[model samples]
Target: MTYTHILTRPVRFFGFAALAALLAAIIFAGAAFGTTVFAAPIERTDVLIGFKNIPGFAEHTLVRAHGGAVTKSFHLVPAVAASLPSAAIRALERNPLVSVVEIDGEFTAIGHSVELDNTWGVAHVGAGSVHHDSVVGTGIKVAIIDTGIDYTHSDLGANYAGGHDFVNGDNDPMDDNGHGTHVAGTAAALLNGAGVVGAAPEARLYGLKVLNASGSGSFSDVIAALQWAVDNGVSVTNNSYGSSRDPGTLVQAAFDNSAAAGVLHIAAAGNEGNCPGNRNTVGYPARYASVVAVAATDKNDKRPCFSSTGPDVELSAPGVSITSTYLGGSYATGSGTSMASPHVAGVAALVMAAGEQSASAVRQILRDTAKPLGDSNHYGHGLIQAVAAVAAVGDSSPPPDDSEPEPEPEPAPEEPTDEPDTTTAVVSDISYSTSGGRTNDRHLTVAITISNGDGAPIGGATVSIDLHRNGSRIASGTGTTNSSGVVSFTLKNAQTGCYSTTVTDVVAEGAQWDGFTPSNEFCK
Candidate 1:
């Protein structure tokens, strides 16, 4: 028996001459150019216009003059989203101020409808163990950028902070489609005893409604949602939506800028995998370097045939028959990379709540601690290990000293015969440098030099450094001094702020530390 395949094609423009005539007739009607004349009707298309420089009043006026209506204006990127006659696209492309004019690409909530069941993803990713350590993503803000969320759901109501709706252009981002609510529940459902709990149960949820009731939306709306998320202090964003085709440079820039602003974007790796061979089928914006692309796995920790695979797949999570919150305060199960993406996003929130604030730091920890699940294309780092990732963060901080100090003993008499005097190590100097071209890539590297009392380099010394930003300790690391008596500490993805580094401790065999305040501070 033969099967019929019905594939959906992207919207295309046609009849350019007729469209031009229609626009001309509308513009020149009742004007000096010509008298009013009827022409063939033309369809308006939504587009994203990228400018060479910061767009302002002149740019807005230019779009208006071309019979275009500006819908969204962005400050992070020099662009404006508008609806205009298809004929005006050529005119805008020819303008010196307009660098790019592309149709706003469409994306959909990527999830396969399935029957409801018990959720095993949380335990599979070790989120349960993380919760035992009190890292339930408390105080971490996660933006669910998809269909709006059911904020009234008992499983998500309390943690639902607030959000914006790009679909209806309203403040209430109530989930019209069940996909966003499901994604939000996977990332952060409440810890109420009656129902299911999320990976980061305590994480604050912000529903940024980009997709509509049909689980479809345009790239321009997604960009607007991203900007809103960044401006509203969202630390992590769960994007379970994307298209197989590229969304263009404008959308890429929006995601990049949002990531640079300290938001960790976790997205689905599109459910378009070909199991017979290794293929590059990952979707954007997940394909972008700035976002973490997650693949879907089954309960047996095996990659599903539908889960897209490529080098961009950063992590894999339980996506098959994963049960989560649905619309109308109900619970449902779904499958796809969509279910997998939120597992990573929730793990990210757990990492942040465990004291890892930097988006890059959280990403590195997730990658470094993931379980090795065979191929990189199938599992990037592997299944995300929330317990291990959060433990890594805990490892960086000093353990609490709760035991009472022992009473000081009387000093013993100095020994008449001594083997040799203990060598004293001192922090001679501290310096720092900034590197990387992009904001998110930029980091702060601090070099600390250790020396002896005679000003000689002291190698083989273990130096502990604490990095602080805005007066709070952000990171701490210990390294052995090399032959040059220097050890460097780097803070990845450093934001614009004041930073300082201090040598907290130094240890060497048969060596003592010289009593001195060794620290340096700088602003970047």
Candidate 2:
């Protein structure tokens, strides 16, 4: 669809239009004649066609001269269309004056993301099961680092606490370009009836505009925006843009800083698929080990053609024909990992909302809960499944100390010798490796084994174990060690910093327990 009378520009009156036209014709003819063709190899002519302000055209039509719109540059989009494959794209490049020919990609009109009302739950259409304890991502702030945002849009205004515009170094994130606005909307549009629903309706959104109106930005600008996201209260960031350049220190360092700060950074896997020329060159921060690279998929969970795919991509999300908020209080549909990145960001908010999940926790949950999408390379872990992800954060902490070290046992001579001591002491070795962890924090793992002397099997003995860390007990549990004397328990979010833990036997009194105390450390 075409927008009408979108923008108006003042015109200057010119009396000698005919004379100027005649002089322009003379120069045009001279340049056209000077252009030559080579029959031996390939013939090409670079002609910069300028469409003088045809009245009634919007400002969008007036392409900036600096970006492939100069008066004497070849029109790449039409050139590619006109030149036959047999002629080769290089034919257009044959001309010394011709630079790169950028095919003007077409964009689709988007539906209002407001069709579905808010259930006050963080869920997507196909998001698996609903978590009984709805994760309220309200307080967690997520930064949408992209073009810019229509922060004033009705559906997006409420969640938009505040943001910065690195492109112009301003606070207002007005989208002179529409790309960033849509991305921000997908990540956290207010659950209002005006426009569209976002993945995380309760999340606070920070708009970091790094690209100009043309949906492009310099590497420096993007890096600066990333730094801004980390410096602010943003715990998660979504970057939909990508570049063809190889990985650079500026981008890598930014990602590393965000990771070090325990912030989740999501980036697009670029638009170039498994193409020959650009195959291994995955997008910047996505390829960076620190960032979670997202790929695009359709509703049916199939990888989209335009989506960039590689081992770098961690997961895929619905990106094709995804509807979201646009500039000027409008809605638009876009298809790219750009759209997918926000989905993961919203999911991250949901996971974080469940509890104080670290960045690594959220990443692992997404990876573990993903629906395997055939090939691992294209979909990474698999399609992002929100419900399963939330559920994976079980009410209890994960099992601890898969590695059960042998416990040093003191002789349980108190038991009957010939009876074979049905009741025997059981123990496992445990230890903590870190020190000076987060202040007032605790982290440790325990290992326990149940058995009689001579490595004889001991069964039916209900042994209760408790962990006392930093002079305060953090974990306690009772279970029977089957066949092989082994039991494990976990304690999470106890306290910050290093703490020495001691194991206690609640059953069989004296001579019933045997194990080493392990140290666990916790930090922010």
- TM-scores, in order shown? 0.69, 0.52
lDDT of each: 0.79, 0.56
The alpha-carbon RMSD values of the candidates against the true structure, listed in the order shown, are 24.5, 30.8
How big is the positional error of residue 398 in model 1, measured in Å on the Cα after superposition? Answer: 3.1
Q: For residues 1-524, what per-residue lDDT tens digits would candidate 2 score against the true structure?
A: 11001001122345698758845753564354331111122232222221222111121112211111111111111111111223333443453334333322221111122232222212453332332344436556788877777877888877776766655544666778787788887777765655666776777777777777777665545555655565554679988877665534434555786687788898787777753323453576688888898887776787766677667878888877777787888877777777788888887877776664588888988898888877766888988877777667655875222122112331221221123343334343333322235553343334455555445544444444445545554444444444544544434334454444333331322223221222333332
The best candidate by lDDT is 1
Instruction: Please list all clashing residue pairs in model 1, or write none if there are none.
Output: 148-175
Worst 10 residues of 2 by lDDT: 1-10
- Report the C-alpha lDDT of model 1 over 448-521, residue by residue, as the tens digit: 78887667777777665557789976665556677778876655567778887655456555455532334468
- Per-candidate clash tally: 1, 21
Report residue 449 deviation for candidate 1 (angstroms): 64
TM-score of 1: 0.69
Where model 1 places Cα greater than 4 Å from the true spot, the runs are 1-41, 394-396, 399-524
